[model samples]
Target: MKQNILTGVLLAVIALLVALPWFAPYFYIFVFTEILILGLFAVSFNLIFGFTGMLSFGHAAYFGMGAYTTAMLLLHLDWPLLYTLVAAMALSGLLALVIGFFCVRLSEVYFAMLTLAFGMMVFTIAHSWRDVTNGSDGIAGFRISEFGLGLDLVMGNPAVYYHVTLAIVVIAALVLYVISRSSFGLILKAIRQNPERVAFCGLNVRSYRLASFVIAGIFAGLAGALMAPFLRVASPELMHWSLSAEPVLMSILGGTGYFMGPFVGAALFVLLETWITSYTGAWMLFLGIVLALMVMFFRKGVLGTFLDWWMNKND
Candidate 1:
């Protein structure tokens, strides 16, 4: 009964999020759009980290690949937005497949190290490939054309773009949520709990891990594809290790145990940055302090700990 109530509340919150742009201040629409993209990115990261227990330090490689893929298509090929997005997902998924094939062969720290290595390799290619990637300047001057779906989509309008991002993100989140609740998800969790035991049960642990990694990359690519036009650039910075860390931080902030934690964490993260940067130049320092406290005290994460308390209190 209590679980039902909590679920209802969560659904209401999502409803509120869906309607946020209608009533929120104009600037807030942009902010929430960013939150949605980063939230999806963090959620994708959590799939392998929380469910599969494989911490990837190179997740941003997929993000950057998706961003660049979409950007390049828009710039040189004059591709439709929908097709660009599809290309982004395909490219990112392929990269994840290659990376995961090697990374999943290892375990624990070895897996992380391999991911980081591959991630750096990706970053280097983006940085040094001046001929195609436009060097440090990245891709620009690519105006967003028709969405090619015969639908009116004004990419220049922030509110309209926000709505577009919201719609796509919600759809992706729903798909990811469904997958998380499936038997495949249960097997991933089982593998996380004990890979040896799962292998003993005749499961190919590495294969499962690889599949999850590819799925994660596909969604991360979606987020990246959305982000390209929003940011108006797909720089090497998107592929940086620092970008990879954003999802990790968001996952930690929200609590890895829960599916919706990353979204909450992304909101908190963007809100905090916006609020803190307005007050002080050392926003990162303040963020670090708050994050340290979150780890020290609310070890379960902002949403995780809050939900834990709420459920306990209701009990």
Candidate 2:
């Protein structure tokens, strides 16, 4: 009975969150969209970092690929939003398959470095390919068309876009959550703890890791596809190493142990950026200081620490 009440309350809260843009100010609607997209990105990163015990520094490669794919589709083909997003996921998944095939052969720091190198290679291509990529300027002036599914959404309205983004993000998060709770996810946890043991049990540990990597890439690509339209441009910066750090930071802030931790962390991060940037241009300095404190004192992350305390108190 108590658990049912708790579940109901949680669902109610989620309902309110989904409806926030309808009541909140216009600027806040944009902020919510950003939080949703980045939260999904962070969650995808956590699948590898938290569950698989792998630290990838080049995750932005798939993200950038998604962004570029969506941008190109919108620019050249002008496909509907749904079709473009599908293309983005496909492109990112293919890239992840190739990259993961190589990276999964290695372990620890070497794997990270190898992924970083490949990511930088992609970044370089986006930066130097003047004819197709438009050099560093990226693809611009693209517009969203019909949303498909028989829903007639006004492309120019931010509110409509926000709802669409919110819906897709929620569905994606749910899919990830289901994956995390499955038998396959338990196998992943086993592999993370002891790959040798998992292999001894006749499990294909490398294949499992590759599967997680590709799924994470697909989710990240979805975030990137949404981002291109939000920003009205897709540039080399989307593929840069700095952009890759965004998800890592959010995961650390939110607590990687919990599925919704990155989403919470992304909200805080985006809100802080919005508030702080209005006061001064030294936001990065403040962010650096906060991150240092988080590393030193709250290694499990904000949600992780809070949940720990709550559980301990109840016990």
Which candidate number maximizes lDDT? 1
Give candidate 2's TM-score: 0.96
TM-score of each: 0.97, 0.96
The residue ranges of model 1 lying beyond 4 angstroms of the native Cα positions read none
Quick one: RMSD of model 1? 1.2
TM-score of 1: 0.97
Separate clash counts for every candidate: 0, 0
Tens-digit per-residue lDDT, 179-263, candidate 2 = 9999988887887899999999998889999999999999999999999999899899988987888888899898988888899
Q: Could you tell me which 10 consecutive residues in candidate 2 have the lowest summed lDDT?
A: 1-10
lDDT values of the candidates? 0.92, 0.89
State in Å the error of residue 229, model 1: 0.4
lDDT of 2 at 201: 94
